[model samples]
Target: MIHPAQSLRTFIGSKNFEESTRFYQTLGFEVKKINPGFSLVKVSGNLCFYLQDYYQKDWCENCMLFLEVEQLDAYWEAVKILGLPEKFKGVKLSEIKKDDWGREFFLHDPAGNLWHFGEFFD
Candidate 1:
């Protein structure tokens, strides 16, 4: 059976919608749709995700996203230089380290949505 959908996009909660959009943009995701209460962001070619203005402590705190990249070190350095954690306000970014998968790191958005960035080992 052929799948009809081309991709899956995750909807992430963002309390501070404006700043949250900026945060994703600063991290290299192209802001496609930005309105009063929602945003559609694209990372690279096919990866995309949504930002909802609605905020729920339970849902936001438990949300997670995993992104794979080719240049892990560069991405880590860029995020550090931009000081995303400080700029995003209450965001946290972990150092990139090697794991069973590959070099990766963790970070959270202002709304508490966790994100894991990694370069898988082939």
Candidate 2:
């Protein structure tokens, strides 16, 4: 029998390890530096990913992570108040957009990784 997986984490590459770590921290993620070249970022205990000191233009630009939230509007407002676009070069944020399935807002990290924060209608 196949056992259920305990947890899952993804590897996100960064163009600059230090700056990328700071970016995530600024975005309110808990970051623990593993070394000079890597760090583990956690949105929560079970929600985490690895940040590696690695990048490829094609891969980094194409990489996208979807984060599901309970309140899209509130999250968007908080994100706006953070002023990430003004603080970090190359960071970009978009207005919340509605889709047939759900609504989401876009955020682009300095390394060009795209993040989709959304919530589905009940």
Candidate 3:
């Protein structure tokens, strides 16, 4: 079995590295490397977003990544300033319904990847 504290990594397939890099950069990711067919963007400590060239068989549906932040409104505001699409449908700051755990909202990236941002108001 895998340890709970073990670091996890995610890879995203992209046909265009420049566009992918720019999109992630708008979401506050720092570009760490840029090559002809691959690029790395740092999301946080020990967490990086990998963008690889898309081939016919290598392309797979991208996965959703969640980011936890303290302030949802401020973060969303900054995201707005970055010119990301506000395509959030059923999620809002005022109406953040929480489960037994905490409150959360989801934002969809240009590549149809969902990013959940949650705050634990416990």
Tens-place lDDT per residue, model 1, 1-122, is: 98698889889898888888888888878987777788789887778888888899899999999888779998888888988877778899999889886888999889999999899899
Off by over 4 Å in 1: none
Of 2 and 3, the candidate ranking higher by TM-score: 2
Tens digits of per-residue lDDT, candidate 2, 43-95, equal 98689999999989899999999999988999999989999999888899999
Best by lDDT: 2
What is the lDDT for 78 in model 3?
Answer: 71
Better of 2 and 3 by lDDT: 2
Q: Residue 107 lDDT in model 2?
A: 98
| Best of the two (1, 2) by lDDT | 2
**Least accurate stretch of 10 residues (summed lDDT) in model 2?**
14-23
By how many angstroms RMSD does model 3 differ from the true structure?
A: 4.9
Regions more than 4 Å wrong, model 2: none
Q: Which 10 residues in a row give candidate 3 its minimum summed lDDT?
A: 87-96
What lDDT tens digits, residue by residue, belong to model 3 across residues 1-122?
96677566677765455666677776778877777777777887867777766633223334567778888767666765654554322212223446677777666554455577777766
Clashing pairs in 3: none
Candidate RMSDs in order:
1.5, 0.9, 4.9
**How much is 89 displaced in model 2, in angstroms?**
1.0
